[model samples]
Target: MPLNKTLSVLLLSLISGGALAAEAGTAFIALPGKAMLADAVRLAATVTAIDPATRTLTLQGDNGQARQVVAGPEVRNFAQIKVGDRVEVRLLESLSLELKKGGAGVRTRVDSVEAARAEDGSAPAGALARSTTVLADVIKVDAKTHSIELKGVSRKLKLKIDNPEQLKQIQVGDQIKGTYIDALGISVTPQPAK
Candidate 1:
């Protein structure tokens, strides 16, 4: 039997609820002893079918790709979906690093996660936020090659400095403070009948 369609549930599965986004492998800001990289992506898929029985779905992408997907148990509130609805996905990623002094002088790390969903259930929406901070000692620096060795909580990391001038501000015995953040968010909205 052909399954009922509400296929954007697949997009819902992809969204996983958290944040806007960042570009891949692109540095947003770079300076001596400091660097930042971040990017974001937003996508919307139009729903073409909603069977309301088997949780099947048909969705069209911006590039005109259409595919079917089965909504698994991980998908919540599928009953709220309908044909002509739109599912949106938002993603964000960021990283920042700096060499500083006057730290505790020991390797350390911190992690955090946050999530939220729509309370009234008018629509399917959720988001998740995650972050981590790491403190490592600058054990070695190679000015010629623009490289540095960092001793972290459990191991060492070798990093190459893209800008030579940025390397000049760093030195051995300094504390390297770094923070990375990522977020994903998803939502569904009804469309006016046309």
Candidate 2:
């Protein structure tokens, strides 16, 4: 066989096996304090309290871990978050958090928040009035019920699909955009789009 053909076969085999295949090498996992301050860490916690004016959030993990997180202006609307509610947050380099809700549990301060508005075109002010946009990667897909498992920042989310056909188009490696609405409960609508 030609060299290129041989290489393609090997690559195909690797992808078919699994993306996170066990390898013979030293793998390192860092704990929260062990990592540098600039490093992003995801923590799942319950909202214990919220200081609206100060924009500080107090969260307690299901296992009893706790931390205070700050929300930035880019978050748009932090006032909607409530005490005793669950939330997932992405921490930016400026030490600000982007609040995301509707996951397995509450997650906080794991990564930077991308800008909400599209850069290619201008959006009318308040165009995204009722919803918050999230960029997440699909971690798991359930074809049976048309639900998808997503990982945003440090939190895992299971989103229900309004259009089963749209869900069918999603693959594990696909990236997704989710719209989150806050009401008596947090709800997420994720669609498979570039």
lDDT of 2 by residue, 1-194 (tens): 43223323423332343321221222233232111112222223456777888777666655565566554444434555566665432221211112222233322222222223212222211111123445666678788877878777657789765455556566675655544332111111222245
Supply candidate 1's per-residue lDDT for 93. Answer: 86
Residue-pair clashes per candidate, as listed? 23, 0
* Per-residue lDDT of candidate 1, residues 63-125 (tens digit): 566656566544567788888888777778899998885463688999987766655556866
Highest lDDT: give the candidate number. Answer: 1
Positional deviation of residue 18's Cα in model 2 after best superposition, in angstroms: 30
Q: Highest TM-score: which candidate? A: 1
